[model samples]
Target: MSRRWLSAVVGSLLALLLVPIAQAADTNLGDLSLSSSNWAEDSGNFPGIWDLTQGDMTISFTYDGNGLVDASGAHAWAELGVRSLHSGGFNFNPNSRYTYNTTTFDLRAEGSSTDVGDVTVSSDETNIYVKFVVNSGSNCTIARTRVQAGSSVSGFPRTWWGDAVPSRFNHQTIHSPQVIEYVYTISRSEVGDGDVYVAANAQIYCDTQRNPRSRIVRTCIDAWAGGVPFSRIGDTRYAIYDSSATRVDGSGVWFASDYDWTAGTFGPDPAGSPSLDIDDKFTISRFGGHAEGDYNLPQTPPDPWNNTHFWFDRDDVDQWQAAMWGMAPGVSYNTNGIYHVVITLHATSATAGTAYMTVNGASQGFYSNGWKDAEPEIYPAGMTFTGDMQQLQVFYGLLGYGATHSVTFSDITIGQ
Candidate 1:
């Protein structure tokens, strides 16, 4: 009623509005932390949980007690759709679904969403989907801001059920009362220090198979008491293995391509007559680079264990020479390496390519054999990459042919 009293009330409201809103603390939700009465309402069955930590992400499913299915344990799957999630603390559901097939533990992103980079998922436990987004793990400056929900067929979007029964799976089966968890991890770099929202969904299928006939059990978003806090990472989100000390643990030779290099061994050991000798090539002991084909020698070496050193014995080869040829399908010579002997390949086209070799990290320039018109006289047999290429390879060589006289190669890496 009075001007003075009205002004005082307005001032108090303004002060409250200006105060910063409190954020949730970071928490680890391992071993069914969501299967508690405190997480859900005092009366209802706990639904599922979507949790994010500094370097880990997870989705969990628990009985919410809405009583959608019986307790014999049906095959269940969980999905988390990005509605609005990023390092900036804003969520916008753009109808995108990041689906996790619980049984197979396969993670896929659909709905034309384009916010982050390639994401790979794997699982050791059946109930949970644990994954790591490779690009997000490597680059911290990049951020992942996604929405909580999407308009996709994968999660079976529903709208009828209310609070008592939010969503229901199409088919029902017997599932015991246990916490089913799906987990994934991204680099702190991908998560930065921001708020992210994931639209959570789960499915229950009969006959122990996952398909369209499966029922939709739950569809919702992740919520926390304090909210998931991403603590600031002072250093890089990922580790670097470039230096010798860092990569000294690395062992074995990396064959450029599986098609040319004989199985069980790398290219022919430094040959004197420039002829391929399958027996003289490097041995296949440890699993390092991706293998595309089988090897010539079937003998399996004892587990390489700490036998991490690669032996590249070129002393026997009076000369290093190669004939240029096009690369085979599903194969390319990756020119990313760091080492005492570095090989750089440039493909001008599908049929033509050139190569340059280096030793001790110095520029040996292109092969000394010289280029011949469109065809190169001496190109790496496995050379396949084209355009501004940088690879890492390390070489330790002794100049002899006896079993004792071989180049030891170890520590292979690609530039970031």
Candidate 2:
């Protein structure tokens, strides 16, 4: 028997034995971190995108079983009602539309001037808008949000109860499972001092789409999905661009209270999903920690940058992630001259990450792992993170260049 033949046989045996174990482990792992009973049915198919946000608390009931399941069969269509703990019973109809601000995620009454409260809702790189709520009170701040998802086809009403004392509503819906996300602000007094409870009211249609508005998402991430780095720029750092084959310092100016020199948003796409679309000016010669980019890298690498210089660790799995530095051509840094620009930091796998440059929306070079030796390799792996990652830091101001130069930035984002 040749050595090669013997090795192949051994490899085959290992695969047969280990593959099943791995598959079984995955099945045993079940859905993502969120509590399964909250949105999962006994049929093993999760058909809704039920999520909530309190303060630092975040919950994303991802559809784990399958992709794009219809609301007709084995699916759920229902309404979710959220109210302050102090308010008795259900505050509003789960299916009724209230006042919501997309830009700030503030929930209030449409006509009433009374202040409801503030609720910040944003999505991850995968485009899943996970609900994150924080309790500002000293007590545990226990509030109740009711959720009821299921259609008539699924039977009479398969309702789920929230944790604490919650109000009730009963309604019916057509067949199929329709996933929806609702953001609301609750009072600390209402919650008393306990955990927040959320569940479906009854298997009915909780129409959350009557008067819908898109949310303004920022790139404050803790995982390695695709997209740029920072979501906002502050007043400390300055952008450096290449003009006439020389590196020039770039400064930004504030237009209105809301508009910064660099406009738009930085981070993942507003529609969700991990991708990059850079239309701003700035430079992040470093990685990981804060720099000129809109966001910072994951914290796994411990230290991601070295004094405005991009750095990565080959031995450390977290440090070996990919990163990019992007600046709009005609606007930010390349106004005087055009050079190789990096607009994205992509991951190909768990062990490898790569960086790339572009010219005129075209590939300027192959992927480069700016770690040991700056070797050319494949992209790093994509990572998913939930919960409180880190506060997004936006650095704005002027750079100490010989000459005075200013640029405006917009649409800054991270994650894909």
Candidate with the greatest TM-score versus the true structure: 2
TM-score for all predictions?
0.19, 0.20
What are the per-residue Cα lDDT tens digits for candidate 1 across 142-178?
A: 1121212112223433333311111343222222441
TM value for model 2: 0.20
- Model 2 stretches astray by more than 4 angstroms: 1-194, 203-345, 349-353, 358-405, 408-416
lDDT agreement of model 1 with the native: 0.23
| lDDT (C-alpha) at residue 85 in model 2 | 21
Alpha carbon lDDT at 202, candidate 1: 26
- For candidate 2, write residues 275-348 as lDDT tens digits: 32222222222221123232223322222222112211111111112233422333222222222222333323
Q: Tell me the whole-model lDDT of each prediction, alpha carbons only.
A: 0.23, 0.23
lDDT score, candidate 2, position 278: 26
Q: Which residue runs of candidate 1 sit more than 4 Å off their true CA positions? A: 1-127, 130-253, 256-339, 343-381, 385-414
